[model samples]
Target: MPAKRWNELSPRTRKLVVVGATVDAVLRIAALVDLARRPAAEVRGSKRRWVLAVTLLNSVGVVPIAYFLRGRRPQPA
Candidate 1:
């Protein structure tokens, strides 16, 4: 099957793609910032591994969400 060029995509499709990409980027940035500020011991796994996964893996915001949900331990009030 032939791949469609950017111009070939419908306006709605293009808007959705752009919105998705923006959300992904925002989530990744938030995750990275949190990782950087939090201590290694506060994280569930090796901070290095989480950094690599969050930065490299393209999970459509899933990876970042996982990092926030499962990677870090709860902080004391």
Candidate 2:
């Protein structure tokens, strides 16, 4: 969006946008850090592919959450 349009938004709207963006950035950073730390053998799918997806896909933490939940192997009992 244009800078003028952004400035025209109410303070509440600006605050919400900033908060949401900060949360998303934190999620992305955390996901990347986890991916780097996780053992390759523990990841269920292709590790490289998942890393690319979580890094490239900018969908408000959805893809990162999916990786943490579904793309990793279950721990041994």
Candidate 3:
């Protein structure tokens, strides 16, 4: 299958692509920083799995959103 070139996209599509990419970048960065600051055991799902999900699942920022929405915060002793 042939990949569609960037120039082939319509103007509106190009704009949307740029905006979506920006959002994904911001969300991914936020997720990474949050995960880094959290204790391994503090993460709701396994720490390793969460990290992988946040970094690996880049489309529409689903994993990153899940981290923020679903990740459990640590309780202070």
**Highest lDDT model number:** 1
Which pairs of residues collide in candidate 2?
none
For candidate 3, the TM-score is 0.81
Error of 2 at 9 (Å): 1.2
List the global CA lDDT of all models.
0.95, 0.83, 0.83
Who wins the TM-score comparison?
Answer: 1
Query: What is the C-alpha local distance difference test score of candidate 2?
Result: 0.83
Tens digits of per-residue lDDT, candidate 2, 13-43, equal 9999999888888877887888788898888
Q: Worst lDDT window (10 residues) for model 2?
A: 1-10
Off by over 4 Å in 3: 1-3, 74-77
Distance from true position, residue 54, model 1, in Å?
0.8
Q: How would you encode candidate 3's per-residue C-alpha lDDT over 5-61 as one tens digit per residue?
A: 999989999999999999999998998898888887777878788878877875698
- Residue pairs with colliding backbones in model 3 are none
State the lDDT at 12 in candidate 1.
100
Residue 72, candidate 2: alpha-carbon lDDT: 76
- Residue pairs whose backbone atoms clash in candidate 1: none
Quote model 2's TM-score.
0.82
Point out the worst 10-residue segment of candidate 3 by lDDT: 67-76
